[model samples]
Target: MTLAAKKKAFVELGKFLGQFASSGSAQKPDVLCNDPFFAGLENLIHTAQHHNGWYTPEQVFFAVQSWANALTPENLDQWLSRYDFAEKSPKTVALILAGNIPLVGFHDFLSVVISGHKALVKLSSNDQQLLPFLAKYLVAVAPKLNDFIEFTDGKLGHFDAVIATGSNNTARYFEYYFRDKPGIIRKNRNSVAVLTGKETREDLVRLGEDIFRYFGLGCRNVSKLFVPKGYDFKDFFEAMFAYGDIIHYEKYANNYDYNKAVFLMSRFNILDNGFLTIKEDTAYGSPISSVFYEYYDDLSDVTKRIETDRDQIQCIVSGVIDYSVPFGKTQQPELWDYADDVDTIKFLQEI
Candidate 1:
């Protein structure tokens, strides 16, 4: 299929996704191929939690809405305009997807197909349902796309290049296994927020979305915080109070209880507000239901430190930090906001 056809198919898929939300699902007759496909999608959205505990209807709806907002014609055009797709031979690109969040590997999948490459996708077991259904939808939109997509359950083989995402240890394995092939092997990376004590109540409240979205599972979720020295967390805690209802989720509540007990038994000083915990930590990755924090003397010093450890960080969120993502926007990455700061489309074109 031509690039225009692929783009049109995804735009239609986005419109299909727009029908779902935590509050309800609505079917618009104008959406492409709405007959049985829309009904199937609605069922998937409602029953996603049955397949995965973390894939609650609300979380799944949020993910769908995020993608719906992203896959507009304007956004797709802006993102693809910078890349040149000339008379290039299409390669079979193997994709090892991550399932930490809904459709986590979708950008890579879209990049491959839109770049005129065939995708040999290995779906994460935890995320087995959504993408394939969407793939079917795309094929229904543009029958030619059927030739461009394939999903594999067995061992992956016969691919010209690879794109893999996994934990740090698994990433090492991916690097070694795909050593001879052109590839992008991603490892564990977390996002962080820098606080300057000047944040408005609204800003911090919005920041709660950055922290609690996806139940703190996605790499884009703000897992760490950097605050000025002697920062009073009273306002921070108060602002975050709005999200206290998150503790009602059984899995998150379980993690909160377990982690809190472990911290107490270890004699580590921690600040808790029943639902969330804030503990002084130097590390970036924090446990679920808790966020790691560090006190910084100066923003410049923190900037220097972050620059040194850029690879370990996925996104830096702050209102004052230069080039940092704004608060509450970490999870809503634009089409051009490539993960690992590596352009997937460019990599696909080159390989």
Candidate 2:
């Protein structure tokens, strides 16, 4: 398929999904939640609910709608149309997905499928349903795609290229396993924030979303913050209180309780909200449910510090900068926002 044709197919898929965004719910989101195969995704939601963290059919629907909306041709043109994929097509592509966030590897999956390559996908147990659902729908929209995409639970054998995402530790494993192949190896990365005194009350609340959404398990989640010196911590505290509902998750609550106790036991005077932890640090990443904060003497200095670490960061969500939307929405990405600084389409074309 040409770039224009692929774009059209994706837009059609997006529109079809958007139609369900209003009132329908996924029948079974779980069976396919960790498996990227059409068989598992056929009826996914209900079967997966008992596993962990509450995710309703309605929420899953919206998540799909949000993903589809972002991938529509219009949005794709805005964020990702720069990469032309007509020339490079891999004979085979292996994709390893991250389950930390839902549908995290969809773009890569689409890039491979659209390029007419056979895909070998290893589903993330944390996020199993999305890819298969998408694949099934793609086959429905364009039957030819069926011959191109395949989901698997086995090893990626004899693939011409590979792309894998995992923690820093797992990255080492992928480096050894796929070392001989042409591929991109991504490691554990955490996004951060640089807060200025000018932030408004609403801005702080959005920051809470950036921190609390998906229980802060996503790479895009802000695990740390840089506050301008003398910045009133009260603003952040009050803002986070607005999202008190997020603390209801059993796992999240447990994480907070455990971490908080550990802090007190060790005489760590870290700032916390019973949901997040703050401390003096120059790092960008944090654990699933904790946040770290450091006060900076100057705003420019903080920016410079972060710019130096930009290569290590995935996305920067901030209240002080003039950017699109607000915080918690960082993971609710726009179309074409490639993850880990790798453009899948471009990679496909290069091969």
Candidate 3:
């Protein structure tokens, strides 16, 4: 299929997804293959939690909406405009997806097929349902796409290139296993925010979305906060209170109870606002229901530190920091917002 054909298929898929949200789902008759896919997708959204406890309907809907916003013709064209897709031979690219969040690895799947290569996807067990369903939808829109997408349950083989996402340990295994082939091995990376004690209440509340969304499972979620020395917690805690209802989720509440107990037992000086906990720590990756914070003496020094440790960080959320993703926008990454600062499309084109 031509690039335009492939792009058009995804654009249709996006329109289908746009009909569903956490608030409710409505079938759009104009959406391609809606008669067959609309009800199935709505069911999937409602029951995703049964397959994976973290895949709440709200979270799944958010993921669906995010992809709906991204797969527009304008956005697709703008992103692909930077690349030359001509004169390239097709290869089978193996994708080892991560299930930390809903549809976490769809971008890689989209990248492989849209670049005129076949995708051999090994869906994360935690995320087994959504992509295959969408793959079916894509094939329905463009029958040729059937030849370009495959899902594997057993050991992956017969792939010319690879993209794998996992924790730091598994990344090493991938590096060694795929050493001979062209590959992109992604490791664990966390996002953080720098607060200068001048943030508006609205900024801080939006920052709560960066922290609590997906129950803080995504790499894009801000797990740490860098604040000026002796920064008051009064306003910060108040801003976080806006998301207090997050505690109603049993899994999150369990983490809060367990982590709070552990902290109390360890005599750690932690602050809690009923649902979330904030502790002063030097680490960037914090546990669920908890956010680590540190005091900074100088913004310049903090910037240099973040620059030096860029590999360990996925995103920095701040209005003041240069290149930082604005507050509340970490999860709504555009097509060009390559994960771990590695461009998947470029990697595929090169391979």
Candidate 4:
């Protein structure tokens, strides 16, 4: 398909997705192929938690809505404007996805398709249905797309290049296995927030979203916090109360109980507010149901330290950090906000 055709197909998919936001879902009369897909997607969104406990209806809807907001014509146009799409013979690119969050690897899939390459996708077992279902929708929107997408449950084969997202350990194996091929292999990355005591109550409230969304499983979720020395948690804890109901979710409650017990057994000092715990630690990746915090004596030193360990961090959330995304916005990444800051389009085009 031509670039224009591909963009049109995606914009249609976006419009179809736009109908299903976190608040609720409704079918749009103008969306193509809704008879076949609309209800199926709704069922998937509702029952996602049955397949993976973390994929609650609320979380699944948020993921769907996030993509809906991203795949618009204006966003696609601006994101693609920077690229040179001079047509070249299509190559088969293998996609090894991460299922930690719903549609976690869809961007890579979209990148391969829009860059005019065939995709050999190996779906993450944890998230098997959503992306393939959308791929079907894409094919329905533009039948020519049928020729460009394929899914595999077994070993990937005969692909010229690859893009893989996985934990740090899996990333090493990917690096060794795909060493001969041009590829983008990603490892574990965690996001953090830097806080000043001067932050407004509203800022802390939104920061709660960064901490608790996706149950803090997504890389974009803020797993750690940087606070000034002697900072009090009284106000921060109060703001986090907005998400207290998150504890009602069985899986998250189980984690909170288990991790809290483990922490107490180790005699580590932790601040708990019934549902979430905050501990003093100098680490980026924290377990679910908890967030790690470190005391920073100077904002400049913290910024310098973050820069030094840039690859380990996926995003920095703060009003103060010059490069940071504002609180609560980390998970809502634009198409140009590539994972690990790796430009998948450039990589695909060059390959």
Candidate 5:
């Protein structure tokens, strides 16, 4: 399919997805292929948790709405405008996706297709259904697109390059196997927030959204915090109260109970508010029901630490810093905010 055709198909997908926002889901008449895909997507959203328990309706809808907002004509045009696609030879780019969060590897897939390359996708078993169904919608919109996309249960048959995301352990295997191919191998990374005592109640509340979204499963979720030496937890705990209802969820509650018990058994110091715990530790990745925090003597010191451990960090959430991700905006990445600071489109163009 032509780039224009692929772009147009994705725009239609954006419109179809736009109908299923978390605010309210309402079908629109202008969306293409809705007669077949609309109800199918809705039913999938309702049953997504059966496929993956982490894919709750609210989180799944949030993921859907994020893609809905992203796959727009304006966004696509603006993002693609920077690259020269003329006379580019197409290659098959294999994608090994991670299922930690919904649609985590979509940007790579979109990058490969829009750059005039074919995709051989190996979906994580935890997130096997959604992307394939969406691929079906795209193929229905533009029949030729069927030639550009493939999903396989067995080994990848043929591919020029690869883009794989996995834990630090699995990443080693990917690096060893795909060493001969031009590929982007992604490893586990976590996001952290830096805080000052000066934050307002509203800022702190929005920061809670950054911490709790996706049950702290996504790479973009802030799992750790850096606070000033004398920072107090009273106000922070009060703000996090907004997410108290999270404890009612069985899986999260189980994690909370289990992790909390483990902490107590270790006799570690922690502050709990029924739903969440904030412990003063120097770790970047934290457990689901708890967030680790460390005391920073100065903002400069924290910046230095982040720069030192840059590979372990995905996003640096902060309200005080101009360069950091805003209070609650870590999960809502723009099309151009490439993960791992790697330009995916540029990678595809070169490959």
Candidate 6:
């Protein structure tokens, strides 16, 4: 399709989504659920929440627009062209999605479909709605593409390609399972920030949002911060105080309390200043109650260290250097970027 035609369809899709966002309902198909994907989404959201999974409309908007813009035909085509999808068509791919954050796996799903391949999707229990809802919409828009996509939970037997995302342990499982197949297996990757004392209150506030959103369960959540030694924690804490409400997540709060108690009892090296807790560790993971902020002697050297560790990092949020946008917002990825650090269309074409 021409870019113009695709954009028009996207505009229509966006309008439909906006209406749904406002009405706060998805019962009727011709309305918000007109796309089959949304219908599945409605059912999925109901199921997810029913089973202790939490998703917000704001997160849904983040997912929808992120998918809409990135997976649109034009953008998909551009990414495909970079790796030559035209020469490699009809690849069958099995996608194992991650649900740590809302709709984290949709981009891989889109890459396979838009590149004209068959997708064997294994849905993550954490996220069961948006992908199916989207698949239905795509088929509705172009019925000719129906057989190109399928959703299944079975073994991805003999599939020519694979894309999987999971934790470090699960990455091992994926590597063993799909070793023969050409694929990309991504493990946990966390995003971080380097906070210079020069940051304004506004920047701190936004940075807090990046860290706290989704209760900091996402891979892109700012799990750690690099700060200059002797930095005044009060200034940063004051700006982030509004997000104290995030403590309401009973499970998350429980984690915080548990970790804090353990640290106090064991005399573990940790910093606590009433609200946020700090610990020093080189691991990409962070505890629920607190984020780890380490002191850096020199900004440039520390930035270089982070660059060396980029494989473990998803994106960095900072005022000093250009980085991909912050976490929570990472789900709303743009058209150009690829997820799990893999090129989608290239894999699809080969299949």
**Model 5: colliding residue pairs:** none
TM-score against native, each model: 0.99, 0.86, 0.99, 0.99, 0.98, 0.84
Ordered by lDDT, highest first, the candidates read 3, 4, 1, 5, 2, 6
User: Which lDDT value does model 6 have at 333?
Assistant: 61
State which candidate, 5 or 6, has the greater TM-score: 5
Worst 10 residues of 1 by lDDT: 41-50
User: Model 3 reaches what TM-score against the true structure?
Assistant: 0.99
Candidate 6 residue pairs in backbone clash:
37-133, 37-134, 88-349, 90-351, 91-351
Q: Give each model's whole-structure lDDT.
A: 0.92, 0.70, 0.95, 0.94, 0.91, 0.69
Query: What lDDT tens digits, residue by residue, belong to model 3 across residues 265-305?
Result: 99999999899999999999999999999999999989998
Q: Over the stretch 273-293, how does candidate 4's per-residue lDDT look in tens digits?
A: 999988898889989999999
Query: After superposing candidate 4, which stretches have Cα over 4 Å from the reference?
Result: none
Candidate 6 lDDT over residue span 1-351, tens digit each: 333443344444554454344247544445433644555555554455544445654455555545545544565455545554343446678888988777777667656665656778998887766667656665566555567778887765657788999989999989998888888899888878888898888888888877777777788778888889888888878877878866665666787888899888988788764556778776667877778878888988778988788788887787776664742365456655665456665555655
Model 3: weakest 10-residue lDDT segment is 21-30
**Global CA lDDT computed for model 6:** 0.69
Can you write out model 5's per-residue Cα lDDT over 172-243, one digit (the tens) per residue?
999999999999999988999999999999989999999999999999999999999989999999999999
Clashes of each: 0, 15, 0, 0, 0, 5
- Over 4 Å off in model 3, which ranges? none
- Name model 1 segments beyond 4 Å from true: none
- Position 264, candidate 6: lDDT: 82
Candidate 5 Cα errors over 4 Å, as ranges = none
- Identify the runs in model 6 with alpha carbons over 4 angstroms from their true place: 1-15, 22-47, 56-58, 68-88, 269-275, 322-331
Q: Which candidate is the best by lDDT?
A: 3
